[model samples]
Target: MKKPVIALLILPFLFFVSSCNRGKAADEVNGNEKKQTKQLDTIVKKTALTIDTVDYNKRMVAMSNNDTTGRWPVKAPYPLPGALLPYNRIIAYYGNLYSTRMGILGELPRNQMIKKLQGEIAKWQVADPTVKTIPALHYIAVTAQGAPGKDNKHRMRMPFKQIDTILSWAKPINALVFLDIQVGHSTVKAEVAELEKYLSLPNVHLGIDPEFSMKNGERPGSKIGHFTAADINDAIDILANIVRKNKLTPKVLVVHRFTQGMVKKYKEIKTVPEVQIVMDMDGFGDKVLKKDSYRSYIYREPVQFTGFKLFYKNDIRKNWVMYTPAELMKFTPKPVYIQYQ
Candidate 1:
């Protein structure tokens, strides 16, 4: 009888010990998760601080009178200026061939010409060895001026016939291709619907041009139409969903901003943890703004990744500058991407 009583007592002790250990393990796991969450939050906050407000009108005014760096407003808590960050690896730009052609003659053979252009891009990889073999992301711009859609219904448009050639060529090279839309008469939701066919492809991304999204009577270059932070966030949400459904890597949403007003509602933009958003400072000119001025005014916005553009002829004379890649590599907060025109 005494032996039986002892066994029962020991059984309860064992159960108590096991329960205590399980609780300890659960606490440990919870603690680790909290730490990781805090780390990610810090990174997101830092990225948000890097966005700056650019004023094109002020810049143009400055440029007309030969004021090189344009006029950037003064702000507080200045970060160390200069090329303090090396941009990210994959870089892209508006297609020079299509952009230039559309700008001048206002027309081109959309289908055949794009295919030939893709072949030319393949040749460029070999011709310019310095063009960064890091497999760039290309944004093919579709506008009303060229490749007009049937019945004037913009949303009915599809990727140009030559787009397949580019896609095929890019696949072999391990590059990414994106369809960029100016969205003159379409909504963000509408444009995404048109682009749904390409979402299944692994190496494709998306870009939106607020520069071309204007109200009635506004021209592309007039800076009349701008996207609200909500508009941008909505587009990001749609892309994130598509990326998740297709089991693809995070989709990249590229936004071109030149001034503070362009991203006025930046603070209100929603943050989607799944997607990577890049805001590029798309300004053109030769004169360098005071590196400190840019950091204080522009690079201080809330964003995940930052981008910079170096015009082959405009930003750097002789297609080169004193700032070496090594020096560029030394930036404290490196740029996520760099673009060369």
Candidate 2:
């Protein structure tokens, strides 16, 4: 009877050990499952948006507060435009043909200018190896300094012939083109429609400087300019149509703003997958002022992307040094678009 009782006790002990091993196996399986879940959540996936003519509004990817970058603590709510992501960043030089002192774009002829740009791009590549550099030509298609011409449009429009010449320069370097518009007294719809031919091109993009919009009949430089949310939405619609008709990649629409009044009803501006809107802080001052302006205007308002403009001469006033790329990246969501004028 004692032997039988001992045998029963041993059997129970063995069963208990087996049960413990099974529990540990279940825990291991759960750990593997959790790791897979994390990888899926963190990985940046490439998404493609289909072009639709009939249902343009339905296709935009509504984004809000993406996952942390680990590098950038402040993350944008929306997914970045697919074309300019993963690691690549755009560095552009802005200027018009009339002003030689304005920016690198107009400072030199094609060959030497490209050589200089190549050097600058190389420097950025060194500063942030993780971010690839994209070169761009931000040619001012309309100048705000001119008189209101035949149509009472104070802005000077660069002729298509000359604009084509600028576009050709991009081909040699495989750069992108931004035809910046300063409407002066003209409407955004009229201005954007004028550039339909160029905007239709794959490499050509659009930039609207509300500083020169002069919504109140004031000359562009006489007072600050403004672009209503409705005006910006109109521009977006034009770009969307161009993208759909051409079956091209996503187009970027840059709106220039430095003050609170430069853009109104900004919250009402709508975006589509076909169009990526950049709210650029076009004003330049000391590094501190620049950061404050960005924080006040851009960071406070959620947008699809952000752009920072650096005025080569103006930024150095009062012995203020422009913010370097490393420092600029410190903003909550780093600016993907960097423009130098």
In the range 27-116, model 1's lDDT, one tens digit per residue, is 775665566556545555544533232332242232123323322221112221111111124544345234553221113343443454
Candidate 2: residue 91 lDDT (0-100): 83
Ten-residue region with minimum lDDT total, candidate 1: 79-88
* RMSD (Å) of each candidate, 1 decimal: 14.0, 14.3
Segments in model 1 whose C-alpha atoms lie over 4 Å from true places: 1-88, 96-133, 144-158, 290-298, 316-332
Q: How many residue-pair clashes does candidate 2 contain?
A: 1
lDDT of model 1 at position 304:
48
User: Residue 290's C-alpha lDDT in candidate 1?
Assistant: 22
lDDT score for candidate 2 against the true structure: 0.75
Q: Rate the local accuracy (lDDT) of all candidates.
A: 0.51, 0.75
